[model samples]
Target: MKRTTFLLVFGVILSFSQAQLDTGGEETGGEEEHVELFTTPATKMGAATSDFGYNLFRALASQEAATNVFLAPISVSAALTQLSMGGSEQAQRQLFRALRYHTLQDPQLHNTLKDLLASVRTPGKGLSTAARIYLSRRLRPKQDFFGLVEQQYGVRPKALSGGPKDVTEINNWVSQETGGKVQRLLTKPLPRNSGVNTVSAAYFKGKWVTRFGQSGAMENFQVDGGVPVRIPMMQQDNYPVKMGADSDLSCTIVQIQMQDDVSMFVFLPDEVTSNMTLLEESLTAEFVQDLSMTLLPAQVFLSLPALRLSYSTDLLPLLSDLGLSDWLADTDLDKISTQSAKLASLNHKVAMETVPEGNQYPSAASSAHLSYRVDRPFLYLIRDESSGALLFIGRVVNPKDLMI
Candidate 1:
């Protein structure tokens, strides 16, 4: 039996005070406002990696046009960043450029990554990220390289035993790290002459800050071409959300809050059959950050389908399209081992689910008038509000395609 790889990437948001909502046409007693800028290394690194994440998403979306695409961009970046630590200068330059970190200096990049990883893995956040470097038993990695990865990334390199048991061991590790949401990451044995293999995984199980009422009824979800499929849809009246519209992309954006400072931004096209090319091309870390600040607070009737999705794919081809084909074809990881070694494989898997659960009950005092329904294909992203890192990004072409 061929075991399939399971990957998922999604996000959540936290509720905010109505005072923070920019309700247009509101005037308060004139008061001065002060704003503090976040120019920390971790934030800078997050912005850079997020750009790479958007690039990766577009590449995948361009290929799989009407199919669902989900991935943890930060996880993939972490895995490749670790690999670059063991690469020669030339290889390092190529990898860093592909990751959109060419401008960042050394040592600082690694240090910032350490800080960013720590921030995202805070306990009780319902989010976790992990990475590992699997080396062949026959090869001996440099002690300095080994120590840096373990100390900085929090995972020591594991020597592959070159046996069927390696598969079980790797799968078990992935399962444990992802809280059992992702399992059997390695369905087959490691490839022959496998010099280095990297695995990165992220898992999120988010609860809404304001939970929706589930009616236990299936509703018709309009896919491309206006075709409809029945699926469970969660509804909430007077839902408090930060909403905005972008005429350039011809989409309406809504921000939903989940627990633990995570915000899920939904981009819904005006029509069921609207082309997503323009919207997809407009995604970037800066674009999202700027858009978030511009949204106004609104009370509206909201309907969304509960999602449980997992996705897995080889990243070499996608990276190649991003101008890293030469590095993928012939790597120079001289710093990793005395023997010439190249990357054997780079695979990423993620699993995420959003249920109709929340921290508090709905308020009945809502004076909502506007309505927003997610009954069609749309794009979404999960971001860590505190660190400004994108935990997950995906396109939901059809909710019924991968239910549970």
Candidate 2:
């Protein structure tokens, strides 16, 4: 039998206060502000990679046992592009092709990656992006690569002397960048042959723009296509939400806005037993884009299960299988230094949660609650509404499994 495929990406953020942005509006926590991006969302590089991401998502989700899966496609691409800057011509071209940018000039790709990084790291969006690049104690990164990373990505490489002591610095930086939500990056130790290695992270969390009230009832969720298990269901009546139908997908699409211009979207098959293969087969970044942009605000009686979970993946084997074998096959990334370097491993980690609005239930706004109810296995998306940057994508086969 063909296994079902659904994709997931997640992150959880505790409240962090900073200087307020100058956008004439208070950001999260009533104090901090994010510096707006240098360019509009329409011109951002994250949008450019959506297609590539869509393809990559499907491939990653197709792996057996990935009943629930999540990965930051933009985060992964951001780090790869940075690494490519110091890679040889063939290596750079291979990287670009894998990300579906085979035709663009290097300058354009670099600029877009730079902007995409800045756009997500803006001060108050409950999202953060950071890159920690390490070089062998014996080798120094080239001055040209150093200057470019600083100028464009606003990050400087920190060289590590041999040993695991630098793990503290790496984890500390990850914690700082993720607001203490992510504590450590490596468990075993740095991968061997990690010449010019980089660790990339994207952490996102936002309270629901339209908060849900605790229904005080246990809802049933299917486990591995088996019997339903009871789980806490967050719900709201008469909430203005966007809803759509993809006849091709046989799934109903719903979009829920979260604070900070971020949105959580769900795609549910019309029936619990419906063939999700059909829905997964029709999936694409462009398809998601059109579905979201086309949803009309309607009074929705929405009910959804609360989610809290963390997941990580070693992307080396997966990426290699996806046609990036050249990078993993003892290939040389000679641009960083004449000394040979190979990306020993590429990993992505995330944490996500959806909680109530400070311990209060919302008063019902309308009578129609049947507009959308997520009762079975489904896919989810967290995205920057303005720039259409996808922050997270995930799937839920068993809601009970998602409870942290």
Candidate 3:
């Protein structure tokens, strides 16, 4: 939706710890299949085409099914945007299949997907004949999302909402459920006296198995919007870089490949005076599919800031700018929200802050979470390791407010 609302929702739903396998793999001491949960959530939330999107979808689907999460809480919005941009209903189904595939992430998680799908895609919701059958056929009956939620997060919704609840109770429950990392969500001032209108909060934390160095921190890296700011620029020289171009945009991505041909392609906006959207919009499925055939490596510097930031913005305007007028329109986006839905306007505030747990460099032997800072705006995606299908996509303009 709007930038602020997106951040606020992100802060609310994703306030969990560094994502880990949800009890379904030997790697993490579970019986379920072991799949690496990357920093990127799998689906490139708003992107229609990108190498990361294509490759991620194929790789994860082929190897192990995946489930993608979009913090925007506006799947319909995202779906509508894609549809308006020529993404068909079939494309939306494929998106759901890939996203619902997260069952492979963990058995419990998978079961959750199964139950949710079954519950929501019932027979009488005006679904087309084909759509009803497709929904029924695609989902499993034994899967229960509540089970997965309990197994993964150690709490149940029933316990959280034991009695009749008000807005304040819901916010408190979320805060307590997420270990106090989230607060003031749908509530007024948190901490009883902070007096800050705690609209919403989301948190995500991840670490590189192989951390980077902190000694070479630099400053004055010009971020988006031509603004020079002080940041700890983590630099890696001689790293492999893949560059490609399409009718839409030219791009450079770092390919982090894993077992069975799965890869995570990171695309950064090429430095320019205008903005990063030029580079991002130009990236598309055809372009990435073309590049996948001929990925060449070039030595380059990967500089990232080591900083924690919090930001606030009004996103109604931004969402409108991004072609999501349907949601902001007075019609109330009737496609998704029914007359019974109780939620008010979706406003969001997100913050991301990370500290180096150990030394910042590999040679020096440290554990540092690679936190990205986009004073302007940046996009990221997770691609299938093998087929180059996109699993998840997201963007951040003001990284400071991200509760990582």
Using TM-score as the measure, the top candidate is: 1
Give the candidates in order of lDDT, highest first.
Answer: 1, 2, 3
The local distance difference test score of model 2 is: 0.65
For model 1, residues 91-184, the per-residue Cα lDDT tens digits are 9899999898975554588888878877777764568776788988778778788888888787888878898899899889988988788877
By TM-score, the candidates rank as: 1, 2, 3
Q: lDDT values of the candidates?
A: 0.78, 0.65, 0.33
The local lDDT score (0 to 100) that residue 3 gets in candidate 2 is 18
Q: In the order shown, what is each candidate's alpha-carbon RMSD?
A: 7.6, 10.1, 16.3
In angstroms, what RMSD does candidate 3 have relative to the true structure? 16.3
lDDT score, residue 190, model 1? 86
Measured by lDDT, the strongest candidate is 1
Q: Candidate 3: where is the Cα deviation over 4 Å?
A: 1-168, 176-180, 187-202, 223-227, 240-248, 256-265, 278-294, 297-299, 307-343, 347-377, 382-404
Residues 1-404, candidate 2, lDDT per residue (tens digit)?
12112121111000110111222123221212112221443433555566566666777777734377776777777777777778778877777788866633445667766666676667656676566567766675677877776676767766776567777777788778788776567665674446666776666666777677655468877655588889888877766566656665667777887777778889887667423555655655545555554454556677888777777666666777557886667556776766777775666677777765532334454475345778788888887767777777887777777633
Per-candidate count of clashing residue pairs (backbone under 3 Å): 12, 20, 63
Error in Å for residue 302 of model 2:
0.9
lDDT of 1: 0.78
Ranked by TM-score, the better of candidates 2 and 3 is 2
- Candidate 3 lDDT over 38-66, as tens digits, reads 22223222122233233332332223211
